[model samples]
Target: MNWILLIIAGLFEVGFATCLGKAKEATGNSALFWMIGFFVCLSISMFLLYRATLTLPIGTAYAVWTGIGAVGTVLVGVFIFKEPATFWRIFFLTTLIGSIAGLKFVSN
Candidate 1:
């Protein structure tokens, strides 16, 4: 259950990051809304991360959380922002995802 929360938190991390990017590109009232979303998502992500740390090893939780966020963010960038999805980038992202899964599998 904790791991599940952690994963959801990681997804929220991706949400916040994407919101930040949109906020950066936005103007006037649009930027305000995106900024609000960024803060809300960030708060939820951090809170869930902290909650997971109560039961899970902090180091493992944090690493996995960040790994999920990083990979998810890269995917969102490629698909939504039309960022380059070069072979090497996809390869590295896949490697990171594998590492994240390995961590989850090895954790107590």
Candidate 2:
């Protein structure tokens, strides 16, 4: 259950990151809306992450959280923002996913 919460938190991290980018691109009321979304998601992500940490090791939980968020954000960039999906980017993303999996495997 803690792992599930951690994963959900990571997904929220991705959402907040995307909201931040949107907020940066927007202006006036649009920017305010995005900023509000960003704060909401950020708060939820942090809360879930804190809950997960009550049971999981801090270092491992943090790394996994960031890894999931990084991967999800990069994918969002490539798909939604039309960012380049270079070979090296995909390779390193795969490596990060592998490392995250390894961390989960090693954790009790």
Candidate 3:
């Protein structure tokens, strides 16, 4: 389904974001490797987003896509990158999750 593709695309968005973070922390060949991964993930994410948009409403799809990416990237930051998980961050994350789920339920 297009929604599934959109979700997958959102995941790839997370992958690219993670790769960027890793690339930033890396040097020499390691940085190059992560950069390559970033480009690959970016390409796949864009392709899936394009495919999903063929049927899904653009506004809804884009919002959901970015929502998923934002949520996933934040979690990744907290877990993988050792970023602080403050109270406000968690509170807003919960709301964002609710919004994403609400969009899914309200959408066709």
Candidate 4:
């Protein structure tokens, strides 16, 4: 359950980050809405992350959380924002995923 929570938190982290980026492009009331959504999601993600770390080691928990978020955010950036998705970018993302999996196994 803690691991599940951690994954959910990671997803929220991606959502908030994407919202923040979109908020920067927004104008007027819509911008405020997106900004608030970003902060709210960010706060919830942090809280869930804290809960997850209570059971999981900080190093493992943080690595997993940030890894998921980073990879997810990059994918969102490419798909949603139409950013470049070069071979090198995907190669690095795969490396990060592998490292996270290795760390989780070793830590366990």
Candidate 5:
């Protein structure tokens, strides 16, 4: 379904973001590889987002896509990058998830 594709696209958005973070930490060949990963993920994410927009409302799809990316990237930061998962961060994340789900529920 398009919604599924939208979710996958959102996940790829997270992939690109993670790649950027890794690329920043890397050097030389490693950094180049990470950048390559970033571009590849970016391409796939964009393509799938376009595809999902065929049937889904653009506003809802975009919001859900960015919401997924934001939630995923934040979790990645907390777990992989060891970034602090403060109370406010977690609270907002939960609200974002609820909003995304609500969009899906309300959409056609």
Candidate 6:
């Protein structure tokens, strides 16, 4: 259950980051909405992450949470926002995923 919460929190982290990015490009009411959403999601995600860390190992929890959020955010930036998805960018993402998986296994 804690792991599930952690994953959900990670997803929210991605959501907040994407929202913040969009907010940066927005104007007026739309910008305010995006900004609010970003902060709310970010706050919730952090709280959930804290809860998860109480039961899960700190290193493992933080690694998985941050890893998923970062990878998801970059993918969102590339696919949704049409940001650069260069070869080097992909290479590092793959490396990060692999390292996170390795860490998970070792921690388990």
Candidate 3's residue-wise lDDT over 43-104, tens digit each?
99999999999998898899999999999999999999999999999999999999999998
Candidate 6 segments exceeding 4 Å error: none
Worst 10 residues of 3 by lDDT: 99-108
RMSD to the hidden true structure, all candidates: 0.5, 0.5, 0.5, 0.8, 0.4, 1.0
Enumerate clash totals for all models, in the order shown. 0, 0, 0, 0, 0, 0
Report how far off residue 70 is in candidate 6 (Å).
Answer: 0.6
lDDT of 6 at 29: 100
Better of 2 and 6 by TM-score: 2
lDDT of 6 by residue, 1-108 (tens): 888898899999999999999999999999999999999999999999999999999989999999999999999999999999899999999999998788777874
Tens-digit per-residue lDDT, 1-108, candidate 1: 999999999999999999999999999999999999999999999999999999999999999999999999999999989999999999999899899999998999
Clashing residue pairs in candidate 4, if any?
A: none
Report clash pairs, candidate 2: none
- Candidates 1 and 5 compared: the better one by TM-score is 5
lDDT to native, each model: 0.96, 0.98, 0.97, 0.94, 0.99, 0.94
TM-scores of the models, in the order given: 0.98, 0.98, 0.98, 0.96, 0.99, 0.94
Native-to-model Cα distance after best TM-score fit, residue 16 in candidate 5, in Å: 0.1
Model 3 score (lDDT):
0.97
Give the top-scoring candidate (TM-score): 5
Which portions of model 1 show Cα errors greater than 4 Å?
none
Q: Please estimate how well model 5 matches the true structure, expressed as its whole-model Cα lDDT.
A: 0.99
Model number with the top lDDT: 5
* 34: Cα error in model 1, Å: 0.2
Better of 1 and 6 by lDDT: 1
Tell me the lDDT of model 6 at 67.
96
lDDT by residue (1-108, candidate 4, tens digit) is 888899999999998999999999999999999999999999999999999998999989999999999999999999999999999999999999999889878975
Estimate the overall C-alpha local distance difference test score of candidate 6: 0.94
